[model samples]
Every structure is written in structure tokens, then in C-alpha cells.
Target: MPRRPISPQLLARQALALLIGYASARVALWLYLPLPWMLGPMFGCTVAALAGAPISGPNQLRMIVIPIIGVLLGSAITLPVLLSMPGWWPAFLVLAPFLLAALAGSYVVFRRLGGFDRSTAFFSAMPGGLNDAMLLGAAAGGDERRIALAHATRILVVVFLIPLFFSLVYGATGSAGGGNPARNVALSALSLSDWAILTAAAALGYWGGKKLDLPAYAVMGPMIVSGAAHVAGIVHVAPPTQLVNLAQLVIGVVIGCRFLGTTFREVSREMAVAGASAAVMIVIALAFAVPVAAIMQMPATQAFLAFSPGGLAEMSLLALSMGEDLAFVSVMHLTRIALVVAMARPIWRWVARRGEKDGA
Candidate 1:
């Protein structure tokens, strides 16, 4: 299918948004804030949208950047990381229970406190797979707008809070590509052959992932291919720091732009509900993360990130910034999204049936 032609007006809006995002990033960097490239733009654009600016993120452009991030993540993988995969089973083992607990807790908050109906509350409280929740919630006769807003608010809050928590509490600070000197290669240092291989990995992996109907395939597919190449010793360096930072900037802009076309007053109550539910989920994540970290012999912060209810990409970016185990964090989030997408509908149906039986 051919692509739709973007109107000139839309282009102008995107440009304005990007400009604001860039300026915000500069201010954040000057203030020595963590993950400035991402958080700065996210906060800036969000405020702009709330203030009624004619701004919109360039989502199409962000898609083009996502593959680069996938490749960058793949570069973090190696023989040792691959070998350590088996040891991660304990973390995986607890994931289902943690998810269930998170769902139940958030459901109570949304349904009872927020006064949302069963379908809307259930879907709104889902911890991951925002797009899936919106689709399934709408199909289940829920308010799609409310579901979307809830998930978006949760994501916005989680993404905004996690990095700040790490930075202030743990004193963590670094660029999104991480602090490993070896991985921070300059763009000019790459050979033409390296560029060719990376490009192919991004293009082919994205196509293959989409063909297989994988969730978040745009990033996951490229990460898989890039990871394989790195493990096989086919690639020796990560994508340049410049490229990674650019990807972060674009992602932040997209996140902030989610609030476009809506004002704070309009969504204030829903945002409060979603924000409270998000807090509930985060506390649950922390409870799981502490024990998992002890068992995994990793930092609690890393484990917390792995279990956080933020978007996969956002958490992965945080992992990169914190110099944590990117592979582990990415895999954990990917698993959560996959499980949610696969099981959410069936579970919702079962719950609905139980509710009906109880009422009868």
C-alpha cells in the first residue's frame, strides 16, 4: 500500500514540535539532568500541548529512528550475556505473578476509586501493551478514549518518574547509549561495510518481525538481527552515540506529543486516576524487583526497571542510560508485552463471565 501524503500544515506542526523539543533538551543538558535528551523533550512537549500549542510529534520520523535504537541495544549483547540467559529464569518465573498482582491492584483502584466500569477499569489497569489494550478494550465495549488516556497517562508518569528516581536516589547519570567507552564509537569511525551490515539488519529484521506479527516488531526485529550479528562477531561496534541520542530525542517528542489535542482540565480527573493506578503498579514492581534483584545478584534499580510498567522502548532506554543489563531489561519488557497481548482478551472474558454469574 502506498503511503498517504502528509499535508504541508502537518509538516509545519511537526517542525515546530521538534524545535521546541530540541530547545528543551538543551535546557535539560545545561541543568545536568539525567536522560536529558529524552525526558527534556517529553516534559517540554507535554507542557506545550497542555498549554494549547499547535505542536505534534513526528511519529513517522520516530519509526525511522527506532530501528537504530534496536541495533544499539543489540550491540550490548555478546557471548557472556548470551551465556547468562539461563540464570535469568528466576526473574522470568516471577513475572506472571507480578503481572497478576499489578493488574488486580490497579483494577481495584480504577474500578472502585475511579468509578470506571469493569471493562474500562480492567483494560485501563493493564501493565503493558498500550496499543493492544486500546484495541481489545474497545472491542470489549469499553470506552476506547478513556482506555487510551489511561494507558498513555500511566506511561507518561512511569517514564517521567523512573529516570528521576534513579538519578536522584541512586546518583545515576549518563547518556542513553551508556558509558562503556568501547560502545561509544563515533559515526565517522565506522567503515562502509559496517554501515551496510547494520542497515541490512534494521531493514530485514523489521520486515521479518512484522511478517511474524511480533509485538513492537519494529525495534525487536532489528534488535534480534543486530544481536545475532554481534554475538557471531559479524559486527564489532555499536551504532554511533550521535545516532542513539537522536533516537532518544525523537522518542521523547513522540511521548510528549501524546497529549496533543487535549487540555489538562479535560483529562485531569482521568489522569489522576491513571496516575494513582500507575503508582500502585510501581509499588508492586518494586516489591518484585527487590527479591528478584537479590536472587539475580544484580542491582535493585536494574530489577526495578525490568519490572516497571513503562513502555518497552522507554524502559530499554532507561537501562541504557543507567548502564544496566540492557538485554535483560529489554527481554523482560518484551515478555510482559507478549504475555499481555496474548492473554488479556481471554482473561477479560473469564472475568466478565464470573462477574455476570455473581450478579445473577
Candidate 2:
């Protein structure tokens, strides 16, 4: 039998349907369900996936991915500078070159992943949510499957390690009694001013995400905007203590879902390689994070979460749980992603040029 090609028009309609469904889910989640933010997207994706809805679309997944890029930019790039600076001017000084090098180095390694080209691999290897990353990868002309796999790998590693890491660092057994409440309650009580700042930061993040053409702008953009707000002394909202646990739950479910139909025997080699790369990335991140945190006089746990290569939501959740600084972690993760994506295209093009010159 010959393969039939799908015309662009039919494809567009399918995509439109998916988008409508996904948007409906997201709005419902935000307004009525009050589930974890992660769950909102997951719910949409799950419905689409289960219904055998074609993944090819101009739907919620793609929209979600765009804002995430902003989140990565905010977390990894902007927040660090804000935290490090004696003033705002000095922050940019540190940010510019750091972003350039990270993107350049990571892209070089990502391209060498055999089947995956630079864009897809870069987005896949990026430290964030799988669905969001895959959507971003697709928008950037990446192999969505590979990106999804890479994200899955990262999530698996984080789920296995974070609890253990927390145990090691905090010297607490895996028990509910380890947490504190009075402090958490105080943190949860967001003031009117704090809400204003959060809203403002979210708006800025969304705008920046759109301008920069990053993925999952809603989550990512808000993170950056809010982070910047905190740094600028416009808001003093900390992570709600309940949100820490909520974040972990979100990550665990999301990561576990990816493994549902996958067989270890089939993906063994790919899994191993992905796991190794992810571990290397995490270690390298930790190396940078510890010293940076020390230099800035930040708590080690907060720094660790800030620096951890776990997905955006996971690390942020951990930060919230430990009563660590969510603003700091959110900014760190956001920046790392933003810089890497921003710089990847130019670096890939340079590599392509160099390859052509060598071939010639």
C-alpha cells in the first residue's frame, strides 16, 4: 500500500480542533479544577493522546511551549544577575557571556546525538517539561519524538534522585513529619501587593516570551517577570509551602506517565545514553550552582534546587517544599533555558558553516 500524503489544509483543521480542546481544558483547570499547573497541560495532552488525536497541531501544546522558553530565560538568565548584582547594572554584565557559552557548548554536544539535529536535540536536552520542550522543539523544527524522549529521561532521573538528594542534604527520612507548618502558613498568605507583583511579572513574562519566540510563555514568562519583580523590590512573595509538595506530585505523575507503554528492552541503549547525558548536565549544573550560591550567600538547598537540572516545575516545587527560595530557582532555570535556545541557532549555523568549509 502506498502512503497517502496529508494536505496542509486538512492538517490545519485537525490542529485547530486539538487547539480548541486543549484551550478549553486549560481554562477549565485554571478556573474550576484548581489542579496543579502541570496537570492542566497534562490533562489536555492525555485526552488528545488517548483519543488517538494526531499530535501534529497548532494547539495548546505549542502555545504552552512558547512561554516556557521565557520561563527558562527568566530562571536561568535574568534571576542570577538580579541575585548576584550589587545593583541591576552589574547583573547584565554577568548574564551576557554566561548565556553565550552555555548555549554554544550545549548545542555542540546536542548535535552529536546521532539521529537528532541541532534544534530538536537542543530543545529535548534542555532542562524543562517534556510536553513543553517537545512543543518548542517542534516550533523550532526539531524531532518532537527525540525531544520527548530526552525530556522523559530527565524526568526519570530527577524523580529517582530528588527525594534521595533531599534526604541526604536535610538528613531526614522520607516522612511527612519533616516539614514545618507555621512558617509555611505565613509564606502562603500572599499580600495584596504580592498578588499585584505576581500579576505584573506574569504579564512581563508573557510579553517577553512572545517577543523572544520562546515556548510555554505563560509559565516561563511569568517566572521571569516575577523573578525580576522580586529582585527589583516590587514584590516579596515566596513560594507557598503547599506548592512545594504540589510541584513534586506534578513531576512524579508527569514523568511516570511517559513510561507507560515504553519497554526497557527496546529503548535500553537510548535510555542509557540519555541518562548519562542528563547526569552529566546535572553535575555540571551543581558545580556552578554551589559556588554561585556561596558567593551570593544563598542557602545551599535553594542553590541546589536553583542549579539542579530537573525540569522547571520539579525544581521549583522542591524549592517551595524546602522553604527555599522559589524566585531564585525559578529565575535560574528560566535563564538557562532562554540562553541556550537564544544562542543555539547561531551556534548551529556556525557549525554548519565550519562543516561545509572542512568538506570543501
Candidate number with greatest TM-score = 1
TM-score of 2: 0.58
lDDT of 2 by residue, 1-360 (tens): 976777787567445444544464356445533223333334454444435444433333333333432332333334455555453232234444544443344444566654557577567565554555666668767787767766677666664465566667665322231123333434447787765565456567778766877654566656657556656666555444344333333333334345434556666666665676666665665666566666667666666666666666556545544556555666666665566556555655675577578772
Best by lDDT: 1
Per-candidate Cα lDDT values, in order, are 0.88, 0.53
User: Which portions of model 2 show Cα errors greater than 4 Å?
Assistant: 1-123, 127-142, 169-215, 221-251
Task: Return the TM-score for each candidate structure.
Answer: 0.96, 0.58
Residue 273, candidate 2: C-alpha displacement in angstroms? 0.9
Q: lDDT for model 1, on a 0 to 1 scale? A: 0.88
- Tens digits of per-residue lDDT for model 1 on 1-360? 999999999999999999999999888888867677888898999999989999878999998999988888788789999999999999999999999999999999999889999999999999998888999999988999899889888988998888778878887776533333345679898899899889998998889989999998988899899999999999887888888878888999998988877899998988999999999999999999999999989999999999999988888888877778889999899899888888798889898998899892
